[model samples]
Target: MLPTTRGDFWAEITQIGMDRLWMQRFHVSLPQVSTVASRPGRRSIGFLTECNSSPLQHCGLNVLSGDIIVNKFDLAHHRSGADYHLGTMSLPTDELDTAVEVIIGRELLKSPDQRIVHPHPALMSRLLKLHKAVGQLARDTPDILERPEVARALENELVHVMVRCLAEGASADTTTGVRRHDAIMARFEEFLEANPDRPLYLTEICAAIGAAERTLRASCEEHLGMGPIRYLTLRRMHLVRRTLLHSDPSKVTVTQVVTDHGFWELGRFSVAYRMLFGESPSCTLRRPAEQPNIHLSRPSSLTTAEPRAT
Candidate 1:
């Protein structure tokens, strides 16, 4: 677990298959944090199961019904809510293909396409059970996990189960729907990331992404549990906090950094930032390079900053 002042960001991994299969459980309580994860060394498949309501509170891109399986080819950014939680089991290039051939009788190993598959009901149930077991094993049985035979057994079981789950979930409609939602959000996120420091209105973003205003708003609300405006603002807030954490107080001012990120309403921004991150912006800016201590709970009475005349 990686500890920060706000809370602990922890991940437990069980390695197997010559460092190919990595069964992992991740959790954090940092508000408005983004995690960029990539495959280790080679291309791999990621079998992910959602853990409670932890990851959803934020506008995470991978939010889907049932267990999800994704092919990781490059770095992917995931946004987290105040309380982030998820579980993952990894499969290497060769192993994933071999498992797919053996279980589902199809070729998938060398496929570079990014795919997100949601397992059907029975398979989702099993996947959830496996997620629980992995968490329990990580917490309770470190000694057993150290045994070579036990680790191999666990890896084999995970690969087989995942293949079965994926095969069962191969419905055209479900796959198309999930892929469409993911594709639309990816476009929106890309646009926002590329224009981070600009104060472009949401309508402009919607136009750039080639979607009607209402359509984009509805898509974001359904997939991300938040509307476009709020998500963009939260993302900008996160960007400002990141800059503050990494910037030298001697070199930069909080107002300068925040304004550059398009946060025009200084008072409301401070109140929202404090509510989300549990500290004032100036505190973060003045600190030596360190992770912000985050708290999941918000202050009951948040005092807004008084707007200064330009």
Candidate 2:
């Protein structure tokens, strides 16, 4: 994922796995945005647990604090505001489908699109507390999951609550305008992927992507929280930083790397780089290679239970 704003980036992620269920709680140290979807064979739910003035944009809609988002196995774009903490869970789609059939007797959702779910405040509170308790187990006492009965009990309860939220919650509808913007963003990303080595001006970007400038501007603003020009430059800046951090300073010069990423003005590039990254390009290149800052818990599974305590 590309960091939208600049700083030393680090993330703390705690993950837990049950027999057929998976869960994650993560926090990033930077203001950033990324798209997340269901894993290849799973259905996922993401909740923005904390926020203040700025609400998160989920699949092109504003998700206020305490709101949960359900991914219909579709690409869901989320932009987090500062002090963001997100919790997510996923299980096999078939498992969810069966549960909906059995419990709710009708499919909670039939559309394959990201939708927001607003549950009662008390119910939402209980879900958050339970999620937080489980995450704590993953971080501080993962061996607790080594107990078969305990793990099974927690997993079942979590699933029950999840189904209840889906069945009883008020699901928000995505506007036609939001869908149009989502399509535009898809094409825009395709263009970026197809031409990764160079920078294009706003006019050329719109022309190549087959989107009008006004429409593209609104799409970017709503989904990306920034103008097209700023988003493009910021993404490229992150790319340059990542390369510089990993490249061998002995063989490559900062000038070569910067120009390769499509920055033509060396002097102005250096200024902008320093302003965003808090360091000069050469300084970043010279630093020794360090381990990635992401902290991920080794996930636990219920199948491997330890011997019962005496």
lDDT of each residue in 1-310, candidate 1, tens digit only = 1112243333323332223566555444443334345566544434335545444321234555464646453434354554455666666667777788988788743333335566677777776786567556655555566667876776677777777876666522334554555567678877887998878787798789887788778767655556888878766776787789889898889899999998888999899888766789998888765533332212111112111100
Per candidate, the number of residue pairs that clash is 4, 0
- How much does candidate 2 score in TM-score? 0.88
* Cα-based TM-score, every candidate: 0.65, 0.88
lDDT of each: 0.60, 0.76
- Model 2 lDDT per residue over 1-310, tens place: 5566665566566678898888887666566777675678788887865544346777568777667888763565678755567888888989988878888788875664547888888777777888889887877777787889989999888888888887788878777888888888878877876776776889998998888999999999998888888878877887888788789999999988988888889899999988887889999999975654344445562212111100
Once fitted onto the true fold, the runs of candidate 1 whose alpha carbons sit more than 4 angstroms away are 1-18, 29-85, 104-150, 169-172, 175-181, 265-268, 287-310
Residue 302 local lDDT, model 1: 15
Which residue segments of model 2 deviate by more than 4 Å? 51-54, 109-114, 293-310
* Most accurate candidate by TM-score: 2
